[model samples]
Structures are given as structure tokens and as C-alpha cells.
Target: MKGMTIIVKTVSSWIKVLVFLFGIYIILFGHLTPGGGFSGGVILAGSYVLLLLAFGREYAEENLPLPIASKLDCIAAFLFIALALLGFIYGAGFFFYNFLQQELMADCNAAGKLVSAGAIPLYNIFIGLKVAASLFLVVLVLSAFRSESDPTEGQE
Candidate 1:
């Protein structure tokens, strides 16, 4: 808010919006694309950083509270681990082979897509959520602390 002039602020605001949209796209397409979990998470966090850089740390914190972000991170990680454990109950042998066997596999498709592999897709989604939340939390916490330490500065 205080750092950038009017022209810079306008351009940066647009950039932040674009970056945020890109991050969302990455997270949603993670299941079908090569970028899953970690990559998408980092992209999401990067968008937050962009917002901080564009506006200020205070703005970022106001938009994404640390407490909420922390809770999201914890929940995402717990869900990922729980999903992995659930595989055992299905006789999958602890994240073991995650396909529908040959008969069901053929019914789905000739060779079946990646998502058709069952637990693997679920795990990917879980990991993606976990990583995104964790990364965002880390960035927000660190940025918050840094901002508090230096009152005069706008953002890093």
C-alpha cells in the first residue's frame, strides 16, 4: 500500500490477480497434468507472495489469516495420511497396487487413464492440498513475523 506509486500499484495489482488465477489453474489441473501436489502448492504460495509484494504484508495477512492458513495446512496433511491408511482396510496392502484389477480395468478403458488407478489419484489430490496449504502457511507466518519486526517496511 505505501510502497508502490499509482502506476506501479495498478500494474502490480493486475499481475497479482493473474498469478493467483494461474495458481488455481495449476492446483485444479494437477490431477490430469504433470504438476501435482508440490508443484501446484508452490505455485499457490507464490501467488500469495506476489500479493504481498504488490500490496503489503498487512494486506496479505488481512486477506489470509495465519490461524486459518495453519488450520488448513494441518487438515490437508491429516487427510493425506488418513487416505493412505484407508488403503489398508480395502486390502490394498498399505498404498499397494491401486488399480481395479484386469476385468474392471478393461471395463473402464482399454488401458485405463491415470486417475483410473484409484488410490493414486486420491493420494495426488491429498498431497497437492497438503503441500499448498503448508507452503502458504509457512510463507504467511514468516512474512508476518518479518513485517512485525520492521514496522517501517511495507513488504519483502
Candidate 2:
């Protein structure tokens, strides 16, 4: 990478890390807080965009590898849908709240805490992963194809 590219990459990588951490925090505290999977996923995707802007499309593609990201996205989507469907087996509606009365469960307040909700937390995780991965992959792939035949256009 060029010196400018290196600087951009470093700063962008730090931003991405911060964005990822914020996304995790949002997802974990989603039940008790305002942000959730969708918001966090958008933030996570923002990191990838930063990377693309800083390093160029080729760098992002080489690092993220479109095929693997695609597969992960598919699997995450399937798992999310499956989890929603699982509620039907317990006589609950789709995406219903079916609490497990296990002793290992965390204590919950009336308004609910970060660890209070059962499936909600798990669902947020799934949605977060799916959204982040999918958005990252999508942006990467899109950037990969954005070019003119000149070849020197994105050389910086």
C-alpha cells in the first residue's frame, strides 16, 4: 500500500473497530437501550464503507472475500428465519416470546435489563451479524465492480 493508503487504512481500520464495538454494545443493550440490530448493522456497514473509501475496492475485496461473506450472510439469514419459526413449535406465534424457565436464566426487572429478555437478545445477535456481514459484502462487491477500463483510474 502507498503511504497515503497506509494512513487511510490505519485510520479506517480503527474506525471500523470502533464501529464494530459500538455495534456489539448496541446489540447487547438493545433490549434495555434504544439501538438494536438494524441500527448496529448500519454502523458496522459504515466501517466497511470507510475501508473501501480508504483502501480502494480491490483491497476490500481481497480482505473480505466476497464468496465467503455471501455464504455467511445466507447462513445467518437462514438461522434468523429458523429461530423465528421455532416459536411455532412451542404453541407461540411467529417470533413470539417463549421464555425458558431454567434456573440458569438471568434475573429480569419489570422494564427488562440488558440480559433480561431471552430470545430477544439472541435474535438481536443474529440480526446484527446478518446485517453487518450482508452489508459489508454487498458494499465490497459493489465497489469491486465500480471501474472504468482505464485501469489507472483508482490508482491514487
Leading candidate by lDDT: 2
- lDDT over C-alpha atoms for residue 89 of model 1: 62
* Clashes (N, CA, C under 3 Å) per candidate: 1, 0
Q: What lDDT does candidate 2 reach at residue 38?
A: 78
| Clash pairs detected, candidate 2 | none
Please state the error at residue 120 of candidate 1 in Å: 2.9
Listed in order, each prediction's TM-score against the native is: 0.74, 0.78
lDDT of each: 0.67, 0.71
Task: List, residue by residue over 1-156, the lDDT tens digit for candidate 1.
Answer: 344567766887778778767766665556567776678678777877766776777787777787887887788778877766665665447564443443245466423345365455566666666776677777767866775688676454
Q: What value of lDDT does candidate 2 attain over all alpha carbons? A: 0.71
The sequence of per-residue lDDT tens digits that candidate 2 reaches over residues 1-156 is: 222457777887778788878888888887778988878877877777777788777666676777877887888788887877777664345455444322235455345655666677777877887888899977766654656544776776
* Alpha carbon deviation, residue 142, candidate 1 (Å): 2.5
- Measured with C-alpha atoms, the lDDT of residue 143 in candidate 2 is 57
